[model samples]
Target chain A: MALEGELAAMMAAAQRGDAAAYRALLKACLPVVAGIARAQGVRGEAVDDVVQDTLMTVHAARASYDPARPFLPWLGAITRRRAIDRLRRAGRRPVEVHDPLAFEAEADPGPAPGAHLETRERGAALARAVAALPEGQRQAVEHLGLRELSLEETAALTGRTKGALKVNLHRAIKALRASLTREGE
Target chain B: MAARHEQLVEDLAGRLAPVRPLPRPGLRAAAWLGAALLLGAVLAMRFAAVGMEGQAPADFQLAMVGALLTAIAAAYAAFVTSVPGRPVGWALLPLPPAALWLGASGLGCLRAWVSPIPDLHGEHEAVGCLGFLVCVSIPLSLLIVAMLRRACPLRPNLTAALAGLAVAAAAATLLAPFHPHDTALVDIFTHAVVVAGVIGVNVLAGGRLLTRG
Candidate 1:
C-alpha cells in the first residue's frame, strides 16, 4: 500500500520528465533487473549493458505507464525481453560460453573457499576444459552440455549417429572432467 | 585514443539514455499509429480465422480487441512519458504496450474460464487459459529484460531479450505436448513471433533514432 503510493508518486514525477524521479525509480529497480540478468546467466561487463538497456527502456516508456496498475511486473517484463535480445545479438561466441552445468553445480553448498574465489577458479577450469577438447568433441559438448541439447538432439544437430553422439559426449565429458581436475589440483 | 574511447562511451551513454523528448508530437503519434495498425492487422486475422468457425462470442471478441488497444495505448503512454529523447524513447516505447497486452490477454483468458461459458470443457478450457498465459508470458518476460537494458545501458538489452526468448521458446516446446493439439501450438507460436517482432521494431527504431539524433 505505502510502497504502491510511493511508486505511484515516483512514476508520476517520472512521467513529467523529472530526471531525479526517473533516476530514483531506476535506482530502486536496479537490483531486480540485475538479479534477473544474473539468474539468466549474464555476467561481468555484459550485465551492465543489460541493465542500461532495461532502464533506458523503462524511462523511455514511462509516460505510457498507468498509475492504476502495478509497476514491478511491467518493469520485469521489459527487463526479460531486453536480456533475451542482447543474448541473441551477441551470437554464439566463445567468450560468452559460460558452462550452464558448472554454473548450477557451483550454486550448491561446497568447500570453504570464498564464493568469488571459488567461482573464478571453477570458471577458469571450465574454460580450460572447453578449450582443450577436440573440435568435434568441443562442438558436441558445447551443443549438448552447455546448450542443454539431449544426445538425440545433439546427433540430429551435428548430423552424427546416436552411437557417434554418445561416444562424442562420453569422450568430451571425460576430457573436460580430467582437464578441470588438473586445473584444480 | 583514450580520449576517443571515452568520447565513444559518452556518446553511447547519451544515445542509450531513456528520455527522448520528441520534437514533433505528430511523428510520435504516427509511430504509435503504425504500431496500432500492425497490431490491429494481426488481431483481425486472428479474429477472422476464429470467426470463420463461429464459435467465439461477439462481445468476447470485442473485449479482446478493446483490451489489446487499451494495453497498447497505455504502454505507449507509459514508455513515452518515462523517457526523455526522441527515437531512443520512441524506439523503446513499445515495451509498455507489449507488456500490457500480455497481462490483459492472460487476465482475459483467465476471466473467460471463470465465466459460465459452456463451449470449452473443463480440461480444454484450463489448457487454453494456461496456454494463453504461457504464450503472452514468453514475450512479457523478454520485454522485461529489454526494459532493464534501456534503463542501465550497461549490457545490450537485445542480448538479454533474445536469450530469454530462446529459453522461453525451448520451455514452450517442452510444454507443447500437454496442450490442446489444435490451438495451443499455433497460439503460442504466433504470440512469440508477434512479441519478437515488436522487440525487433523497437531495436531498429532505436538504432535509427540514435544515428539520426
Candidate 2:
C-alpha cells in the first residue's frame, strides 16, 4: 500500500498553473519551511529572507517534483540548500562597526558660507566627476561612497571580490581628487 | 516591498506555467521493454558473430528478469522520493528484485563473499569492468533523472543513489553474457561492487544536480 496525500496532490495542481492551488500549497508549506529554517540556526530578518529565498527556489524548482511521490523530501532538500546559502553569506560578510556620533550632530558648527559653498561646489563636482571614472570604480563609489554602505555590503551586493572593491574605491577616490583639482582652477 | 512571503508567492504564481507530467508507469515500462528487446537483439547478433551459442540457465534467466525489475522499481522509487517528505523507505523498492538476482547466484555467490584486500592497483580489466558498468549506467540513470526532473526531489543523494542502483543493476545484467568464465561468486561480487560504486559516486555528486535550488 502507498501513502496517498494532500501536499503532493496540491503541488501537482499548482504545477498545472492553478493559481489558487499554488497559493494554497505555498501557504501550507510555509510553516514547515519556517520551522526547518529556524531549526537550522537562521534568526531574525535572515530567517524571513531565507524562507523567501526557499519559496523562490521551490517555485523555480517546482517542475522537478513528482505528484505520484510523497513531497517532504523534495521540499526539505530545497529548504536545506537555501538555509545553508544564507548561513554562508551571513558568515562571510564583515560586521559593520557602530558609530556613536552617527546620529549625534557635530559638537561644534563649522565655518559658514564660504566653506559650505566650497563644499557644495565640491559635492556637485564630485557627483559629476564620479561618472567619468571606469565602470568598476564608478560602481564602487556608488555603493561604498554615495550609498554609504560598508565594504562588506558592497562586496555582497555587487558580487565583486573584496580586494577588487577596495582597489576600485581607492582608484575612484584618486580619480575624483584629480578631477576636482582641475575644476578648482 | 512588503511581506516577503506574500510577495514571493504572488510573484511566482503570477509568472507560473506548468507542463504536462511524463507518461504513466505503464508507458514507461513499455518503453523500457523495447529497450530490453533491442539490447537482447544486439547481444544475440554479437553471439552469432562469435559462433557462440548456449541456453541461458534457469537461474540466470531469473536473475536477468530480476535485474530489469529492480531497474524499473528503483527508477519509480527515485521519482516518487523526489517529492518532499516522501518516506525514504521507498528507496528500498529495489530489494525484492535484488534478492531474486542474488538468490539466482546460488551458494557460489555466498562462498565467494571473501573479498580480497581492496587495492588501488587493481587489474586493468577490473578497472575496465568499472568503466563498462558506469558507461551503461549513465544513460539509464540520465533517463531516470530526466523522467523525475518534473518532480522536485528533496533528498537528492537518496534519489540519485536509487537511480544509480537501478541503472547499475541493468548494466550488471547486460555484462553477464559477455563476461568470460562466469561464476556465481564473480557474478554477484562484480555486480554488487559495480552497483555500490556507481551509487556511491552518484549519491555524492548528484545531490546538487538533482535537487538544485
Candidate 3:
C-alpha cells in the first residue's frame, strides 16, 4: 500500500511536469513492468521489448491516469497488454532456426557401403513418383521444387492461381514422400 | 539494454510537460451526451418544421428513453474502458437499454404490420429516414471517436464499438421525433441494418483511428 501510494505520488508529480520526478517514476516503473512482463510469459529479449512498449504507452497515455485511482493497477494493465501483444506477434511469425548443427550431427563418423547406389535409387524413385502426379501437381512440382522457380513465375507459366500452385505443390510433395517410402520398403 | 533503458527515461523526462488530465469518464460522457442530445433536438425540430406527417406511436417515448439511456451508458463505457485496467465488461453497460430500444421498436413494427395504418402523412420516405439516421450517426461517431483517441484503449475495437452503439442509439432516439410515424417492418429492419453497419465500421476502422496516435 505504501509503495502504491509512493508510486502514485510520483506519477502525480510527473503529470505536473516535474522532470526529475518523472524520471524517477519511469526508473521505478522499469523493474515492475519487467516483472509483470515475465509473469505474462514474455521471455528474454522480448521482455525488454514489452517493457519499452509499456513505458511508451504510459508516456503517451499519462494524461489518462486519474490521481484518485491507484497507479499500480493502471501500470499493471498497460504492462500486461504490451506483453500479450508481443506474445501474439511472436505466435504469428515463423520461428527462426538459429543453429542447424543443433538438429544434425556435426560430422558423420562413418558411411555404409553401397550408399551411392542407394542414393541413386532413391533419386530415381522420387523422379518417377513426381512424374506420376496429376498434370497440375506435376507442373507445380517441376517448376516450384525441381526447377526452383519462384511462386510468381510458376503461377504465370502454368496459368494457375498462386493458391492452387501452393496446394498442388504441397500435395505433390506428400505423394512423392509416400511413393519413395513405399519404394524403400 | 540497461543503458538504452536509462536513455529512454532521460528522453521521456526531457520531454515532460505539464498536462491537464482528462475529465473523469462520467463527466466526459455527460458532456458528449449533452452535445448529442442538442444536435438530436435540432434535427428533430428541423424535420418537424419540414412537416413530418404521422403521429408518434404510444411506445415512442419508451423507445426514446431507451435510446437516450443507451447513449449515456455506451458513451460512459467507451470512455471508462478506454483507460487501461478497466474491465472489458464495461462495454456491456449499454446492453439493457439497447434491448429496451430494440424491443420497443420491434413492437412498433409489429403493430404496424398487424394493423397496416394508411399512409396518412405520405411524407415519410424510408430513404429520408435512412439518410437522417446515417447523417446524424456519422458526426456522433466521429466526435466520440475523436474523444476516445486521447486515451490508450488496449481493446480499441471494443471501445470503438461502444462509441458506435452510443452514436447509433442517440441517432435512433431522434428518429421518433424526426419521422413521427409508425415503424413498418422495413423501417425497423433498416434501422437495425444501419445500427449494425455503424458498429461494424467502428470495429473495423475506428480501432485503427484510435491507435493511430
* Candidate 2 structure, TM-score to reference: 0.55
Give the i-RMS of model 1 in Å.
Answer: 9.4
Docking class of 2: acceptable
In model 3, which residue pairs have backbone atoms overlapping below 3 Å? Answer: none
DockQ of 1: 0.02
User: What are the TM-scores, per candidate, against the unseen true structure?
Assistant: 0.30, 0.55, 0.76
DockQ of each: 0.02, 0.26, 0.45
Is candidate 1 or 2 superior in TM-score? 2
Best by DockQ: 3
Per-residue lDDT of candidate 1, residues B33-86 (tens digit): 454345334534553332234444443343344434434443343333323322
Q: B1-213, model 3: which lDDT tens digit per residue?
A: 988889888988999999878889999999998888788778756666443445566676677789888988999999999988777788888999999988888888888888987764554477888899889988888889989988788888889989989888988877766564677787888889999999998888898998722
Q: How far in Å is the alpha carbon of B95 misplaced in model 3?
A: 0.8
What lDDT score is found at residue B149 in candidate 2? 55
Error of 3 at A101 (Å): 15
- Provide the clashing-pair count of each candidate structure: 93, 21, 0
Candidate 3 per-residue lDDT, tens place, A22-55, comes to 8989999999999999999999999999988988
